[model samples]
Target: MPGKRPLNAAIIPSAKRERKAITLDIKLEVLRRFEVGEKLSQIAKALGLAVSTVATIRDNKEKIKASSQVTTPLRASRLTRHRSAVMENMERLLSVWLEDQSQRNVPMSVSAIQEKAKSLFDDLQRQQGESSQTEKFSASKGWFVRFKERHCLPHFKVNSTSPGSNADTYPDVLKSLIEEGEYTSRQVFNVDETGLYWKRMPEGMFISVEEKAEPGFKSSKDRLMLLLGGNAAGDFKLKPLLVYRSEDPEALKGYSKPNLPVIWRSNKKAWATRAIFHEWFTYFFCPAVEKYCAQNNLTNKALLILDSAPCHPVNLSDLSDNVRVEYLQDSTADSMQPMGQGVASIFKAHYLRRIFEHILEATDGEDKATIREFWRNYDIVDAVDNIAVAWEELKPATMNSVWKKIWPECVHFQSFSQTDNIAWLQRNIMALAKNVAFEEVVEADVGRLLQSHEEDLSNEELMQLERERAVGEGENEDAPPALRQLTTEALSVAFSHFEAGLQILTSNSPDEEWKFKVSRAINDAINCYRELYNEKKRRSKQLS
Candidate 1:
C-alpha cells in the first residue's frame, strides 16, 4: 500500500494485547470526562491510549481506585500485572499474617515475608489438588521489594509493643483528644463492619430433618457484610452500607442501580476487602460526613475511628484536612468500638423484629397456627429491606449511651439501655418463634439471636468463597416479570390496597382529575392484558 508502515511488532489486528500501565490521574480524568458525556474513544485518544483502555477504566472504576491509592501525594500507577497467583488471595493471606505478627509484636524481615508467601502458596496448591512444583516459587528479593511497596508494608525494627498489647496508649490517646477539645461527640464516629447471615435463623430450625440428612443444609446461609457508621452522640447516623456475595444477586435483578435505598455493593466473598473499603471511603463515607457536618452547622472537622482489620486500606488517601482517621488498637476493638458496645446488637434485634413483623403482616390477621406456612418463602430481598429498617429504628438515645465508657462527657442520660431492648427482643422473638418452631428450638434460637455475633470465617472458607462461581445463569428471566405471579385472591387483596388509595384521593382531592387518570390507567392495563392473552391463546392453537 502507500509505503506500508515498518512492521514494528506486527500490529496483528487481534484481541490479545499487552496490558498498559496507566497512571491513576489519567484513569480518573477519563472517567470524569465520561461522566460529562465525552465519548470514550475521544477521551482515550486525548489521553494517548486505546479506546478499550478508557472503556476498561469506566467498567472497573472501583477496582482501579482501590489499586491506585497514593503513597506520597503522587498519582500512583494503578495498573496490575496479570498473573496466575490471584492478588485477592495473596492480599488476604499476607494481610492476615501481618496483622497477626503486628499483634504479637513481631517484626517481619524480607526473607521472612518470602518464606510465608511460599508457604501460603504451597498450602493453597495442596488444597487445590494441584501437583506441587519440584521447587517452590522463590519469592525472590526483587519480588519481595515490589510486594512490600505494593502493599505499603513497612520494615522497621521492632521497638515498641504491639498495638494489641499496648491497650493503655489507645485510651490515653482518645482521652487526650477529648480533653484537648480536638473533636466533639458529634464529630466522633466509629465505623465497623461485620458479617451477617441475613437469612439464617439462630439455628437450623428452618431446615427439615430429612433435608438436613440429605445433603447441603445451607438454605439459610445467605450472607452479607454490613458496615455500620455512627457518631458517639448518636445525633447523626450515616446510612449503613450492605455488601452482598454475588455480582448481581437474584434479589436485585430488576432494580434500578441509581435509585437503591442503601449504598450497596457486592463481592464474591461476602466478607469485606480493601478494595470495597476504599470505595466506601471515597464515595459513601466522605460525601455523607461532609453533608452531615454541613447540615448540622457543626465544624467540618470529623474523626472517624476504625479497627485494624486486614481489609482496611494501608493509606486512605485524598481525605480532606478536616477529616481524620484513627485506627483502634488491635484486640481492643471489642472493648473500644462504639458500634460493638450496643448499636450493632440493637440493630440486629430490630432486624429480627422487623422480620417477625413481616411474618405477622403476611398472615393477614390469620391464626398464629398459619405463621409457619406464610414464613417459609422469605428470601434475601426481605432480609435486605429489614436490614435498612433495623438500622433506621435504632433510637438516638440507645446509640448515644453506647459511648459512655470512652466519651462519658458526651453521654447523655437516657431512660432505656440496650439491656432493656435486648430483653424486649428476646421476649418478643421467643414468642414469635414458638408460634412457628419447636419450643426447645425456640429457646436455643432465642438465646443465639440475643448473643453477640461471632466471627467464624476460616481462611479456607474465605478462599473457597473467592473462587468464581456462576450464579443463576442461563435461566430465562422474563423482562417486566411481575414482582410475583399474582393469584386471583392475591389480586383481590391488592385491589383493596389500590381501592383504599383511590378512595383517599376521591375524598381528599379538590377535583376528579386524579380519579380520571387512575381509572384510565386501569382500563388501559386491562385492555392490554386482554389483547395479550387472546394473542397467546391464538398462537397456542396454531402451534398445536
Candidate 2:
C-alpha cells in the first residue's frame, strides 16, 4: 500500500539539496595559490568557497593540472569532461600556438584558428599513423564556439584598440595624474620586452657564413625575450630580465642565476608569462627600487608604467603598497609607449652593434678554428655578457630623451645626441659587419633585422616552434645553481692578479698622475674582495 502523502508534500523540497559546481578555472586558481604558500582558509575566503571545497581542490590538484594540460587553463571554466586522445593532442598544440601568437601581439581571426585546428589535426593523424576509420574533425563553427569558450581566446578582448587612436588623449590623462601625484622623473619607470635572436646574425648572413665554413652548419633561430626598464630620470636602470627557452643551457652550467647580469627566467617558448612577471615585480623590482630610493634620498613611492601586454597581470597594483602600476593606452604602444618611442630601438641597435663587435674581434686574426668555435660556442652566456655591456652603453641622457614623446615634462634637458642616434649605430654596425667579412650587409639589412623581432611568426616557423616545445616535454625546468662560496685561496689569487696587472700598468706608464689614478681605481675596485678575503680567513681561524 502507498504511504499517505503529507498535506504540504507538493511544496516540500527534496532532502538532498543540489551542490554548486566548482569550475575547473576556480580549482586551478586555488591550486596556484596553494602552491604559492597561500593558506587554505584565505583562498577559500578570497574565492567565496568553503574551506572543505578548497581542501578538496588542493587534494585533487594533480588531476586538475593534468586535465588543464589538454586545454588552456583559464579557459577551462566548465566541469571536466572526457575527451578523445586525438582531440586533446590537437587542442594542446593549438593552445600553445595561440599563446605564442598572443605573446607576439599577433591578432587572430576565427577562420584562421579554425584552419589551424584542422591542419594540426591532420598533422597529428599523420604522425600517429591513425587509420582512416578514425573519427574526422570538422573544426566547424560549433567546435570553434566551444573552443573559444574553453580557451578564452584573445583573453576576453577581441581587440585592444585601433592603432594610435589613444596617442593624444592618454598622454593628457597621464600628465594630469603626474601633476596631481607630484611624481618626479625618478619616481616614474617604464618597462617592455622584445624578442632577440641571441645567436643569429642578420637574416641570410648567418646562413651564408655558416654554409661556407661547414656543410653541417645550421642557421640558428634560437630566441630569447628581454625586459628592459628605467626611471624617467635615467639615473636608475633596472637589471634586465631575460627569459630563455632553457633555464639551464649547457653554456650556463655552474653559474649562479641570482648573480647573473639579468634576472633569468624560462619556459618552453621563452615568452614572458604572468607568473614570471609577478615574480619579478615581487622579488627583484620592489627590493631594487626600495634600495635605490633609500640611497638617493627620494621618497619610497614609485610609479611603474607598462604597455598593454598580455603577460602583465591586472593585480600588479595589489602586489606592492609603495609601487603603483599604470598601463599605457592599447594599440598606441608604437606611438606613445616610452620604451617603444626610440628607447627599445636604441637598445636593439646597441645589442646588434655589440654582436658585430664580437664577430670582428673573433675573426681579427682570421683563425678558421677560432671563428668556428666562436660560432659553435656562442650561446646564451655570451649573449648575456653582451647584453650587459650593451645596456651599460646606453647614456642617461638617451634614456631620458625617450620620455620626450610620452611625457615631455619628465624628460631632462641634456645633449642626448650622440648615443641616441640610430643612424650612427647603423653605420658602426655596418662597418663591423664588413670587417667580419659580411661585405654585402648594408644599413637597410640592419634595419630589417631589428624589425624582424617584432614581426609575426610564419606558419612554418610556428610549426617548428611547436615541435621544439614538444621535444622539451616531460623535462622539468632546472633550478639555478646555488651560489658558490668564495674560498680564501681563490680570493688571494684574484687579488694577486689584480695587483700584478696594476703594477705592470704603473711601470709602463710615463705620466705620474695617470699612474696614481689607475692604481687608486684598481685598489678601490678590489676593496670588496679584500674584505671578503679577510672574512674568510677569520672564519677559518675560528673553525681551527
Candidate 3:
C-alpha cells in the first residue's frame, strides 16, 4: 500500500557480488607474482581480478594458506560452506578407509563409496558437535565423481585379481627366451622401481612427535623412485633412472639434461609413471641393450622381466622381435624377483652412505655451528649424483647373487660374505659420521636409517608423496646464490669437500688394500687440484 519513491530515494543493489572466493592456487599465484616484483594492479589485471582482491590474497596468504588448500574446497561452496573442518576430517578419514578397503581387496563400487562417504561425513559432524546444522551430506554422485578424480583413483571399475599359480611356469618361460631367442644370461634383464625417503633419519634421532609431525617434514613423503635393472650374470647393469620431485629444479640449472650423471626424470610424485616407463624402455633401455649386445658380439636379442604393477607399461611396441618383455606372476616378487635378492639392498645401502658422504663432503672444514647451514645446499640435485655413484658401486657379486632364489642355476658363488661387507660399510659409516660429520653416529643409527631408507609404503602414502612440489619450490632461492660456474672459490670448495671424504676413508680403511685405495684417491684428488690451479694461473697470465 506504499507508492513508489522518487528517483533519489530508489535503492540500488550492491555492485560487488560477494566476490567469488579466491582459491588456494589463485592465492599462490598472487603471492608468487608479488614476490617477483610485479605490481598489485599488474597482477590483478593479468588474472582478471580486482586490485583489492589481489591485495587481499597477498595480505592474508600465509594465514589463509595454512587452512585452505585444493583438497578443502572454498567456503562459498555449498558442500563446505560453514564446516570446512568437517569436510577435511571426513576426507582424510575416508581416504584412509578407502585405501584400507583397497588393500583388503574389497570391491570399491561407486555407490558403495558414496554411501561410505556420506556415513563418514555424518559421523564427523556429530563428533564435532555440529549435527544441528540441518544440512545433511549426500555425497551426491556429482561430488563423489569429482572427489574420486581428485584422489587419482581410477574409474569405478573393480580390479579382478586372480590367485597366481603360474610362478613355476616362469622358469620355463625364461628357458624359452634363452633357448629360442638365444638370449644369454647377460642379456636377460629384470627391472624394478623402489621409493626412497632421502631426508629421513633413524627414529632414535628424534622424538615421535618430531619425527611424525602431521604438518611438518614427512620423510616418508619426501621420496624419490629408483628404476634399477641388471642381468642375472651381473655382467651388465642398466644406467639407473632417478626420479625427483621437480621438473626443472634450480639446483640443477647449470647442468645440461643430456649430460646428467644419471637418467634423470621428474614429476610431482617423483614416481615412474606409465609414460615415463614407456619412454625409458624405448629410448634408454633399448639403446643401452643394443650397444651392450654389439659389444658382446651377440645378436640384438634381449629379454626384460617386470612386476605386475598396473602402471607398468606391458607393451614394447617400439622394439618388437629383438626384445621380449615378460611380467612376473602376481605374488611372486618376494620369492622370484631378481632385484629382491640383494641388488636393491646393495644399491640402497650404497645410496645412503653416499648421501652422508656428500653431506660430509659439502660441510667439510666449515665451522661446527655453521655445519647445519651447508646441509641446506645439499638438495635433490646433489642427491641424484650421489645416487648414481652409489648404483655404480654395486659389486658384481651382489648383482649376480640376486638370482639365487629365482634362478639358482645362474648363481656361481654364495653371497655369505655380504654380511661382512655390510658390517664393513656400517663401520665406515660410523667412522665418517663421527670423524667427518659434526655429530656422532652409532652402528644401529647407521643400519636402521640405511635399512629403512626405503619404507614399505602403503599405496596411499605412495600417491600423496608423489604429488609435485609446490609452485615456488623448484625456483632458485633468494639467498645462497646459485653456483653456476667453476670459479676459483668453487675449486677451493671442491678440494675441501674431497679432503673431508679422504680423511674419513683414511681413518676407516680396514686393510692394506683399503689403505692403498684411499692413498690412490688422495693422489688423484691432489693431481686434479694441481691441474685446476695451473689452468687458473694460465688464465690469469693471459688476462694480464
RMSD for each model, in Å, please?
16.6, 11.2, 14.3
TM-score for candidate 3, please give it: 0.58
Q: Give the candidate number with the greatest TM-score.
A: 2
Worst 10 residues of 1 by lDDT: 476-485
TM-score of each: 0.55, 0.65, 0.58
- lDDT (0 to 1) per candidate: 0.64, 0.76, 0.66
Candidate 3 global Cα RMSD: 14.3
lDDT of 3 by residue, 1-544 (tens): 9998666432344475444556556676677567645578868987889988888788886775565544545542532233355665566556655643432223457777777777777765776685545666789888877687645665433533556546566676667667777767787899887767766554543322354756744544567778888888987888888777666878788888867767877755455666677778865787677768877898887888887664476677454557888877555654688886667776777876786677676666746424445444457776777777888898788788777766667777684456777777777766666665435456776687766645444433533532322334444322221223356777778778877887888788778788777778677636645555677778888999
Per-residue error (Å), model 3, residue 491: 36
Candidate 1: list runs displaced more than 4 Å: 1-165, 178-182, 204-217, 365-376, 414-416, 435-440, 449-453, 458-544
Ranking of all candidate structures by their TM-score, best first? 2, 3, 1
Candidate 3 regions exceeding 4 Å error are 1-165, 205-221, 363-370, 415-420, 437-440, 456-544
Instruction: Encode model 1's per-residue lDDT on 28-123: one tens digit a residue.
Output: 767666664456776887778988778888999887667666434443533332334333355557655664454223445667667777766766
